[model samples]
Target: TAAPGPQLFLSLCLSRLKFPSDLDELRELAETLKFYKQEHYGYVLLLYCSAYLYKQSFAIPGSSLLNMLAGAIFGPWEGLFLACLLTTSGSTFCFLLSRAFGKQYVVHFFPEKVALLQRKAEENRSSLFFFLLFLRFFPMTPNWFLNITCPVLNIPMPIFFSSVFIGLIPYNFICVRTGSILSEISSLDDIFSWGTLAQLLAIALVALLPGALIKRYGHAHLKVDGLDGDGRDQAGRHRKRR
Candidate 1:
Protein backbone atom coordinates (compact mmCIF):
# COMPACT_ATOMS: atom_id res chain seq x y z
CA THR A 1 0.00 0.00 0.00
CA ALA A 2 1.10 3.57 -0.60
CA ALA A 3 2.27 5.63 2.36
CA PRO A 4 -0.58 7.79 3.62
CA GLY A 5 1.58 10.90 4.03
CA PRO A 6 2.97 10.79 0.48
CA GLN A 7 -0.42 9.87 -0.94
CA LEU A 8 -2.11 12.75 0.82
CA PHE A 9 0.51 15.19 -0.36
CA LEU A 10 0.17 14.06 -3.97
CA SER A 11 -3.60 14.24 -3.80
CA LEU A 12 -3.55 17.73 -2.37
CA CYS A 13 -1.15 18.93 -5.04
CA LEU A 14 -3.18 17.36 -7.81
CA SER A 15 -6.32 19.03 -6.55
CA ARG A 16 -4.85 22.52 -6.35
CA LEU A 17 -2.00 22.71 -8.83
CA LYS A 18 -2.76 24.84 -11.86
CA PHE A 19 -1.05 27.31 -14.22
CA PRO A 20 -2.64 30.72 -14.55
CA SER A 21 -3.22 31.95 -18.10
CA ASP A 22 -4.41 35.51 -17.53
CA LEU A 23 -4.34 38.20 -14.88
CA ASP A 24 -7.62 37.11 -13.33
CA GLU A 25 -6.58 33.51 -13.35
CA LEU A 26 -3.18 34.49 -12.02
CA ARG A 27 -4.71 36.28 -9.06
CA GLU A 28 -6.97 33.38 -8.26
CA LEU A 29 -4.19 30.88 -8.61
CA ALA A 30 -1.88 32.94 -6.48
CA GLU A 31 -4.41 33.13 -3.70
CA THR A 32 -4.97 29.40 -3.78
CA LEU A 33 -1.25 28.61 -3.87
CA LYS A 34 -0.38 31.09 -1.19
CA PHE A 35 -2.75 29.41 1.24
CA TYR A 36 -1.39 26.02 0.28
CA LYS A 37 2.16 27.29 0.70
CA GLN A 38 1.42 28.31 4.25
CA GLU A 39 0.49 24.78 5.13
CA HIS A 40 3.15 22.99 3.09
CA TYR A 41 6.00 25.39 2.78
CA GLY A 42 8.70 22.86 2.01
CA TYR A 43 6.65 21.06 -0.62
CA VAL A 44 5.58 24.32 -2.19
CA LEU A 45 9.15 25.57 -2.27
CA LEU A 46 10.37 22.36 -3.87
CA LEU A 47 7.58 22.41 -6.43
CA TYR A 48 8.18 26.04 -7.31
CA CYS A 49 11.90 25.55 -7.73
CA SER A 50 11.39 22.44 -9.83
CA ALA A 51 8.89 24.11 -12.14
CA TYR A 52 11.07 27.25 -12.39
CA LEU A 53 14.22 25.34 -13.24
CA TYR A 54 12.37 23.23 -15.78
CA LYS A 55 11.05 26.28 -17.59
CA GLN A 56 14.41 28.03 -17.49
CA SER A 57 16.49 25.01 -18.48
CA PHE A 58 14.25 24.29 -21.44
CA ALA A 59 13.92 27.91 -22.57
CA ILE A 60 10.20 27.87 -21.99
CA PRO A 61 8.28 31.13 -21.92
CA GLY A 62 5.97 32.44 -19.19
CA SER A 63 8.61 32.98 -16.53
CA SER A 64 6.96 36.30 -15.77
CA LEU A 65 3.98 34.45 -14.41
CA LEU A 66 6.19 32.31 -12.22
CA ASN A 67 8.03 35.34 -10.96
CA MET A 68 4.78 36.91 -9.85
CA LEU A 69 3.72 33.67 -8.29
CA ALA A 70 6.90 33.61 -6.25
CA GLY A 71 6.23 37.10 -4.97
CA ALA A 72 2.67 36.33 -4.06
CA ILE A 73 3.80 33.38 -2.00
CA PHE A 74 7.20 34.42 -0.70
CA GLY A 75 6.95 38.20 -0.66
CA PRO A 76 9.04 40.67 -2.72
CA TRP A 77 12.65 40.36 -1.59
CA GLU A 78 12.61 36.60 -1.19
CA GLY A 79 10.82 36.17 -4.48
CA LEU A 80 13.29 38.40 -6.29
CA PHE A 81 16.24 36.48 -4.90
CA LEU A 82 14.69 33.15 -5.84
CA ALA A 83 13.83 34.34 -9.34
CA CYS A 84 17.34 35.63 -9.98
CA LEU A 85 19.00 32.48 -8.70
CA LEU A 86 16.74 30.25 -10.71
CA THR A 87 17.14 32.36 -13.82
CA THR A 88 20.91 32.15 -13.67
CA SER A 89 21.03 28.47 -12.79
CA GLY A 90 18.44 27.47 -15.35
CA SER A 91 20.04 29.62 -18.05
CA THR A 92 23.38 28.00 -17.31
CA PHE A 93 21.80 24.59 -17.78
CA CYS A 94 20.42 25.71 -21.13
CA PHE A 95 23.81 27.06 -22.13
CA LEU A 96 25.51 23.83 -21.26
CA LEU A 97 22.87 21.84 -23.13
CA SER A 98 23.28 24.03 -26.18
CA ARG A 99 27.02 23.56 -26.06
CA ALA A 100 26.69 19.81 -25.80
CA PHE A 101 23.82 19.01 -28.18
CA GLY A 102 22.16 22.01 -29.82
CA LYS A 103 25.09 23.78 -31.46
CA GLN A 104 24.74 22.25 -34.91
CA TYR A 105 20.96 22.57 -34.87
CA VAL A 106 21.04 26.20 -33.72
CA VAL A 107 23.64 27.09 -36.30
CA HIS A 108 21.77 25.26 -39.06
CA PHE A 109 18.33 26.67 -38.25
CA PHE A 110 19.37 30.24 -37.43
CA PRO A 111 22.40 30.74 -39.61
CA GLU A 112 21.89 34.46 -40.18
CA LYS A 113 21.11 35.14 -36.52
CA VAL A 114 24.08 33.11 -35.40
CA ALA A 115 26.31 34.96 -37.83
CA LEU A 116 25.03 38.34 -36.70
CA LEU A 117 25.49 37.51 -33.04
CA GLN A 118 28.98 36.22 -33.77
CA ARG A 119 29.92 39.51 -35.36
CA LYS A 120 28.52 41.48 -32.47
CA ALA A 121 30.31 39.28 -29.95
CA GLU A 122 33.61 39.70 -31.74
CA GLU A 123 33.11 43.45 -31.98
CA ASN A 124 32.73 43.65 -28.22
CA ARG A 125 35.07 40.86 -27.16
CA SER A 126 37.20 43.31 -25.21
CA SER A 127 34.19 44.14 -23.03
CA LEU A 128 32.16 41.05 -23.69
CA PHE A 129 30.89 40.76 -20.10
CA PHE A 130 29.44 44.27 -20.13
CA PHE A 131 27.95 43.64 -23.56
CA LEU A 132 26.21 40.56 -22.16
CA LEU A 133 24.96 42.58 -19.18
CA PHE A 134 23.53 45.15 -21.57
CA LEU A 135 21.65 42.47 -23.47
CA ARG A 136 20.22 41.08 -20.24
CA PHE A 137 19.20 44.52 -18.95
CA PHE A 138 17.39 45.43 -22.16
CA PRO A 139 13.79 44.36 -21.79
CA MET A 140 13.35 43.87 -25.52
CA THR A 141 16.25 41.50 -25.87
CA PRO A 142 15.25 37.83 -26.15
CA ASN A 143 16.99 36.13 -23.22
CA TRP A 144 16.11 32.63 -24.41
CA PHE A 145 17.99 33.28 -27.63
CA LEU A 146 21.04 34.38 -25.71
CA ASN A 147 20.90 31.39 -23.35
CA ILE A 148 21.03 28.99 -26.23
CA THR A 149 23.55 30.89 -28.31
CA CYS A 150 26.11 31.92 -25.70
CA PRO A 151 27.96 28.63 -25.89
CA VAL A 152 28.14 28.87 -29.64
CA LEU A 153 29.58 32.37 -29.32
CA ASN A 154 32.24 30.92 -27.02
CA ILE A 155 31.15 33.10 -24.12
CA PRO A 156 32.74 31.91 -20.91
CA MET A 157 30.39 30.33 -18.36
CA PRO A 158 31.34 32.63 -15.49
CA ILE A 159 30.60 35.77 -17.50
CA PHE A 160 27.36 34.35 -18.79
CA PHE A 161 26.23 33.38 -15.27
CA SER A 162 27.18 36.70 -13.70
CA SER A 163 25.52 38.73 -16.44
CA VAL A 164 22.25 36.84 -16.14
CA PHE A 165 22.28 36.97 -12.33
CA ILE A 166 22.95 40.69 -12.15
CA GLY A 167 21.38 41.98 -15.34
CA LEU A 168 17.90 40.58 -14.80
CA ILE A 169 17.59 41.98 -11.27
CA PRO A 170 15.53 45.02 -12.22
CA TYR A 171 13.14 43.04 -14.36
CA ASN A 172 12.73 40.37 -11.70
CA PHE A 173 12.23 42.96 -9.02
CA ILE A 174 9.37 44.51 -10.94
CA CYS A 175 7.62 41.20 -11.41
CA VAL A 176 8.05 40.15 -7.78
CA ARG A 177 6.98 43.51 -6.43
CA THR A 178 3.88 43.49 -8.60
CA GLY A 179 3.10 40.04 -7.35
CA SER A 180 3.28 41.15 -3.74
CA ILE A 181 0.47 43.57 -4.51
CA LEU A 182 -1.46 41.14 -6.63
CA SER A 183 -4.82 42.28 -5.36
CA GLU A 184 -4.23 45.79 -6.64
CA ILE A 185 -2.97 44.93 -10.10
CA SER A 186 -5.69 44.95 -12.77
CA SER A 187 -3.68 43.97 -15.82
CA LEU A 188 -0.39 42.45 -16.86
CA ASP A 189 0.38 45.58 -18.84
CA ASP A 190 0.63 47.55 -15.64
CA ILE A 191 3.65 45.52 -14.59
CA PHE A 192 5.57 46.62 -17.64
CA SER A 193 4.46 50.17 -18.20
CA TRP A 194 6.28 52.62 -20.43
CA GLY A 195 8.11 53.97 -17.41
CA THR A 196 9.42 50.53 -16.56
CA LEU A 197 10.57 49.98 -20.12
CA ALA A 198 12.37 53.31 -20.17
CA GLN A 199 14.15 52.42 -16.94
CA LEU A 200 15.27 49.11 -18.38
CA LEU A 201 16.47 50.82 -21.52
CA ALA A 202 18.42 53.32 -19.49
CA ILE A 203 20.10 50.56 -17.52
CA ALA A 204 20.97 48.74 -20.74
CA LEU A 205 22.55 51.88 -22.13
CA VAL A 206 24.61 52.28 -18.98
CA ALA A 207 25.81 48.69 -19.21
CA LEU A 208 26.85 49.19 -22.83
CA LEU A 209 28.73 52.42 -22.16
CA PRO A 210 31.64 50.66 -20.49
CA GLY A 211 31.98 48.32 -23.45
CA ALA A 212 31.86 51.20 -25.88
CA LEU A 213 34.63 53.01 -24.04
CA ILE A 214 36.74 49.87 -23.88
CA LYS A 215 36.35 49.27 -27.59
CA ARG A 216 37.13 52.83 -28.59
CA TYR A 217 39.78 54.01 -26.14
CA GLY A 218 41.21 50.95 -24.37
CA HIS A 219 42.15 49.10 -27.57
CA ALA A 220 45.50 50.85 -27.98
CA HIS A 221 46.45 49.88 -24.46
CA LEU A 222 45.18 46.25 -24.45
CA LYS A 223 47.73 43.65 -25.56
CA VAL A 224 45.95 40.87 -27.43
CA ASP A 225 47.60 37.95 -29.19
CA GLY A 226 47.47 37.54 -32.98
CA LEU A 227 46.64 41.21 -33.49
CA ASP A 228 48.43 43.74 -35.74
CA GLY A 229 48.37 47.52 -35.72
CA ASP A 230 44.93 49.14 -35.70
CA GLY A 231 43.81 46.15 -33.59
CA ARG A 232 42.88 43.96 -36.55
CA ASP A 233 43.60 40.27 -36.24
CA GLN A 234 45.79 38.63 -38.87
CA ALA A 235 42.93 36.34 -39.91
CA GLY A 236 40.58 39.28 -40.52
CA ARG A 237 43.22 41.60 -41.89
CA HIS A 238 40.81 44.43 -42.68
CA ARG A 239 38.36 44.05 -39.79
CA LYS A 240 38.96 45.96 -36.54
CA ARG A 241 39.50 43.63 -33.58
CA ARG A 242 37.81 44.06 -30.23
Candidate 2:
Protein backbone atom coordinates (compact mmCIF):
# COMPACT_ATOMS: atom_id res chain seq x y z
CA THR A 1 0.00 0.00 0.00
CA ALA A 2 1.43 3.40 -0.92
CA ALA A 3 -0.23 5.19 1.98
CA PRO A 4 -1.83 8.02 0.10
CA GLY A 5 -4.30 8.89 2.85
CA PRO A 6 -3.40 12.56 3.07
CA GLN A 7 -3.23 12.95 -0.69
CA LEU A 8 -6.71 11.56 -1.09
CA PHE A 9 -7.85 13.84 1.71
CA LEU A 10 -6.25 16.85 0.07
CA SER A 11 -7.83 16.11 -3.27
CA LEU A 12 -11.20 15.32 -1.76
CA CYS A 13 -11.36 18.53 0.25
CA LEU A 14 -10.81 20.80 -2.70
CA SER A 15 -14.38 21.73 -3.70
CA ARG A 16 -13.09 22.78 -7.06
CA LEU A 17 -11.49 19.40 -7.80
CA LYS A 18 -13.51 16.87 -9.72
CA PHE A 19 -13.12 13.44 -8.24
CA PRO A 20 -13.93 10.60 -10.60
CA SER A 21 -17.30 9.08 -9.79
CA ASP A 22 -15.64 5.68 -9.92
CA LEU A 23 -13.52 6.74 -6.91
CA ASP A 24 -10.56 5.11 -8.68
CA GLU A 25 -8.61 8.29 -8.35
CA LEU A 26 -8.45 7.69 -4.62
CA ARG A 27 -6.38 4.55 -5.21
CA GLU A 28 -3.81 6.39 -7.30
CA LEU A 29 -3.74 9.25 -4.84
CA ALA A 30 -3.14 6.83 -2.00
CA GLU A 31 -0.33 5.15 -3.86
CA THR A 32 1.21 8.51 -4.54
CA LEU A 33 1.03 9.42 -0.84
CA LYS A 34 3.37 6.58 -0.09
CA PHE A 35 6.05 8.52 -1.95
CA TYR A 36 5.15 12.21 -1.72
CA LYS A 37 5.07 12.74 2.04
CA GLN A 38 7.40 15.72 1.95
CA GLU A 39 7.60 17.68 5.21
CA HIS A 40 7.54 21.17 3.73
CA TYR A 41 4.99 20.32 1.12
CA GLY A 42 2.87 18.50 3.69
CA TYR A 43 2.67 21.67 5.77
CA VAL A 44 1.26 23.46 2.76
CA LEU A 45 -1.14 20.58 2.23
CA LEU A 46 -2.37 20.85 5.79
CA LEU A 47 -3.17 24.55 5.37
CA TYR A 48 -5.01 23.85 2.16
CA CYS A 49 -6.79 20.96 3.85
CA SER A 50 -7.95 23.05 6.81
CA ALA A 51 -9.23 25.91 4.65
CA TYR A 52 -10.81 23.64 2.07
CA LEU A 53 -12.66 21.69 4.71
CA TYR A 54 -14.04 24.97 6.04
CA LYS A 55 -15.05 26.04 2.55
CA GLN A 56 -16.67 22.76 1.53
CA SER A 57 -18.76 21.90 4.58
CA PHE A 58 -17.34 23.33 7.82
CA ALA A 59 -16.53 19.77 8.77
CA ILE A 60 -13.16 19.87 10.44
CA PRO A 61 -13.18 16.38 11.82
CA GLY A 62 -9.82 15.07 13.00
CA SER A 63 -8.79 18.70 13.32
CA SER A 64 -6.49 17.77 16.17
CA LEU A 65 -4.79 15.21 14.01
CA LEU A 66 -4.43 17.71 11.19
CA ASN A 67 -2.93 20.28 13.56
CA MET A 68 -0.58 17.68 14.94
CA LEU A 69 0.40 16.89 11.39
CA ALA A 70 1.06 20.58 10.93
CA GLY A 71 3.43 20.66 13.91
CA ALA A 72 5.10 17.52 12.65
CA ILE A 73 5.55 18.80 9.11
CA PHE A 74 6.13 22.50 9.68
CA GLY A 75 7.59 22.32 13.18
CA PRO A 76 5.28 24.83 14.94
CA TRP A 77 5.42 28.47 13.78
CA GLU A 78 4.55 28.19 10.11
CA GLY A 79 2.33 25.22 10.90
CA LEU A 80 0.45 27.24 13.51
CA PHE A 81 -0.10 30.14 11.15
CA LEU A 82 -1.28 27.91 8.34
CA ALA A 83 -3.71 26.05 10.57
CA CYS A 84 -5.18 29.21 12.12
CA LEU A 85 -5.51 31.08 8.84
CA LEU A 86 -7.18 28.23 6.98
CA THR A 87 -9.56 27.48 9.82
CA THR A 88 -10.59 31.12 10.07
CA SER A 89 -11.01 31.46 6.33
CA GLY A 90 -13.14 28.33 6.14
CA SER A 91 -15.39 29.60 8.93
CA THR A 92 -15.79 32.99 7.30
CA PHE A 93 -16.67 31.35 3.99
CA CYS A 94 -19.56 29.50 5.60
CA PHE A 95 -20.84 32.69 7.23
CA LEU A 96 -20.85 34.34 3.83
CA LEU A 97 -22.35 31.30 2.13
CA SER A 98 -25.22 31.55 4.59
CA ARG A 99 -25.96 35.03 3.34
CA ALA A 100 -26.31 33.86 -0.25
CA PHE A 101 -28.22 30.60 0.36
CA GLY A 102 -31.35 31.73 2.31
CA LYS A 103 -33.40 30.31 5.19
CA GLN A 104 -34.65 27.21 3.36
CA TYR A 105 -31.11 25.96 2.96
CA VAL A 106 -30.40 26.42 6.68
CA VAL A 107 -33.66 24.71 7.54
CA HIS A 108 -32.85 21.71 5.37
CA PHE A 109 -29.22 21.31 6.40
CA PHE A 110 -29.68 22.23 10.06
CA PRO A 111 -33.24 21.17 10.70
CA GLU A 112 -32.58 19.65 14.08
CA LYS A 113 -31.31 22.84 15.76
CA VAL A 114 -32.48 26.46 16.00
CA ALA A 115 -33.47 27.36 19.55
CA LEU A 116 -31.14 29.79 21.34
CA LEU A 117 -30.25 31.45 18.09
CA GLN A 118 -32.77 34.15 18.86
CA ARG A 119 -30.88 35.16 21.99
CA LYS A 120 -27.62 34.94 20.11
CA ALA A 121 -29.11 36.85 17.23
CA GLU A 122 -30.16 39.61 19.56
CA GLU A 123 -26.79 39.68 21.32
CA ASN A 124 -24.24 39.21 18.55
CA ARG A 125 -26.54 40.27 15.76
CA SER A 126 -24.80 43.57 16.09
CA SER A 127 -21.40 41.87 15.98
CA LEU A 128 -21.05 38.98 13.53
CA PHE A 129 -17.47 38.09 14.43
CA PHE A 130 -17.93 37.90 18.18
CA PHE A 131 -21.25 36.13 17.85
CA LEU A 132 -19.71 33.47 15.63
CA LEU A 133 -16.82 33.12 18.08
CA PHE A 134 -19.24 32.73 20.96
CA LEU A 135 -21.06 30.15 18.86
CA ARG A 136 -17.80 28.32 18.15
CA PHE A 137 -16.92 28.34 21.85
CA PHE A 138 -19.82 26.61 23.57
CA PRO A 139 -20.89 24.83 20.45
CA MET A 140 -23.16 21.88 20.62
CA THR A 141 -25.33 24.16 18.45
CA PRO A 142 -25.91 23.74 14.74
CA ASN A 143 -23.44 26.03 12.92
CA TRP A 144 -25.00 26.15 9.47
CA PHE A 145 -28.28 27.17 11.05
CA LEU A 146 -26.69 30.28 12.45
CA ASN A 147 -24.70 30.96 9.31
CA ILE A 148 -27.65 30.91 6.96
CA THR A 149 -30.09 32.61 9.29
CA CYS A 150 -27.68 35.41 10.17
CA PRO A 151 -27.77 37.01 6.75
CA VAL A 152 -31.52 36.61 6.18
CA LEU A 153 -31.97 38.19 9.59
CA ASN A 154 -29.78 41.16 8.53
CA ILE A 155 -26.52 40.53 10.42
CA PRO A 156 -23.41 42.16 8.99
CA MET A 157 -20.50 40.22 7.52
CA PRO A 158 -17.74 42.20 9.22
CA ILE A 159 -18.96 41.25 12.71
CA PHE A 160 -19.41 37.62 11.69
CA PHE A 161 -15.90 37.15 10.33
CA SER A 162 -14.21 39.17 13.04
CA SER A 163 -15.81 37.30 15.94
CA VAL A 164 -15.32 33.94 14.29
CA PHE A 165 -11.67 34.56 13.47
CA ILE A 166 -10.85 35.89 16.91
CA GLY A 167 -13.19 33.70 18.95
CA LEU A 168 -12.07 30.47 17.31
CA ILE A 169 -8.38 31.12 17.89
CA PRO A 170 -8.26 29.15 21.12
CA TYR A 171 -9.81 26.03 19.66
CA ASN A 172 -7.76 26.18 16.49
CA PHE A 173 -4.52 26.61 18.45
CA ILE A 174 -5.35 23.54 20.49
CA CYS A 175 -6.00 21.51 17.35
CA VAL A 176 -2.82 22.65 15.64
CA ARG A 177 -0.71 21.90 18.69
CA THR A 178 -2.23 18.45 18.86
CA GLY A 179 -1.13 17.83 15.29
CA SER A 180 2.38 18.92 16.18
CA ILE A 181 2.47 16.53 19.10
CA LEU A 182 1.29 13.68 16.89
CA SER A 183 4.18 14.43 14.60
CA GLU A 184 6.48 14.17 17.59
CA ILE A 185 5.23 10.89 19.04
CA SER A 186 5.92 7.40 17.76
CA SER A 187 2.55 5.72 18.38
CA LEU A 188 -1.11 6.30 19.08
CA ASP A 189 -0.73 5.53 22.79
CA ASP A 190 1.41 8.62 23.16
CA ILE A 191 -1.48 10.69 21.95
CA PHE A 192 -3.44 9.63 25.03
CA SER A 193 -0.69 10.46 27.48
CA TRP A 194 -1.36 13.12 30.11
CA GLY A 195 1.36 15.36 28.73
CA THR A 196 -0.35 15.73 25.38
CA LEU A 197 -3.66 16.60 26.97
CA ALA A 198 -1.98 19.05 29.29
CA GLN A 199 -0.19 20.72 26.43
CA LEU A 200 -3.38 21.13 24.46
CA LEU A 201 -5.22 22.55 27.44
CA ALA A 202 -2.45 25.01 28.05
CA ILE A 203 -2.48 26.19 24.47
CA ALA A 204 -6.25 26.55 24.44
CA LEU A 205 -6.07 28.74 27.54
CA VAL A 206 -3.29 30.81 26.05
CA ALA A 207 -5.20 31.41 22.85
CA LEU A 208 -8.31 32.35 24.79
CA LEU A 209 -6.48 34.87 26.93
CA PRO A 210 -6.42 37.55 24.24
CA GLY A 211 -10.09 37.17 23.53
CA ALA A 212 -10.87 37.44 27.19
CA LEU A 213 -8.77 40.52 27.46
CA ILE A 214 -10.54 42.08 24.53
CA LYS A 215 -13.89 41.20 26.01
CA ARG A 216 -13.02 42.75 29.33
CA TYR A 217 -11.70 45.84 27.64
CA GLY A 218 -14.81 46.17 25.55
CA HIS A 219 -17.12 45.85 28.52
CA ALA A 220 -15.08 48.40 30.41
CA HIS A 221 -15.20 50.86 27.52
CA LEU A 222 -18.81 50.33 26.52
CA LYS A 223 -20.32 51.91 29.61
CA VAL A 224 -22.54 54.88 28.76
CA ASP A 225 -21.93 56.44 32.19
CA GLY A 226 -25.61 56.84 33.00
CA LEU A 227 -26.53 58.72 29.85
CA ASP A 228 -30.13 57.48 29.69
CA GLY A 229 -31.03 56.00 26.26
CA ASP A 230 -27.49 56.75 25.02
CA GLY A 231 -25.13 59.57 24.05
CA ARG A 232 -22.92 61.79 26.29
CA ASP A 233 -20.58 60.89 29.15
CA GLN A 234 -21.00 61.98 32.79
CA ALA A 235 -20.03 65.48 31.79
CA GLY A 236 -22.17 65.33 28.61
CA ARG A 237 -19.88 65.85 25.60
CA HIS A 238 -21.49 63.20 23.39
CA ARG A 239 -19.93 59.87 24.38
CA LYS A 240 -20.64 57.30 21.68
CA ARG A 241 -20.07 53.69 22.74
CA ARG A 242 -19.55 50.35 21.01
Per-candidate local distance difference test: 0.73, 0.52
RMSD after Cα superposition, model 1: 9.6
Backbone clash pairs for candidate 1 read none
* Root-mean-square deviation per candidate: 9.6, 12.1
| Number of clashing pairs per prediction, in order | 0, 13
TM-score of 2: 0.56
**TM-score against truth, every candidate:** 0.73, 0.56
lDDT score of residue 77 within candidate 2: 76
Over 190-236, each residue of candidate 1 has an lDDT whose tens digit, in order, gives 55778556645664665566556644543454322222222222213
Which candidate gets the maximum lDDT versus the true structure? 1
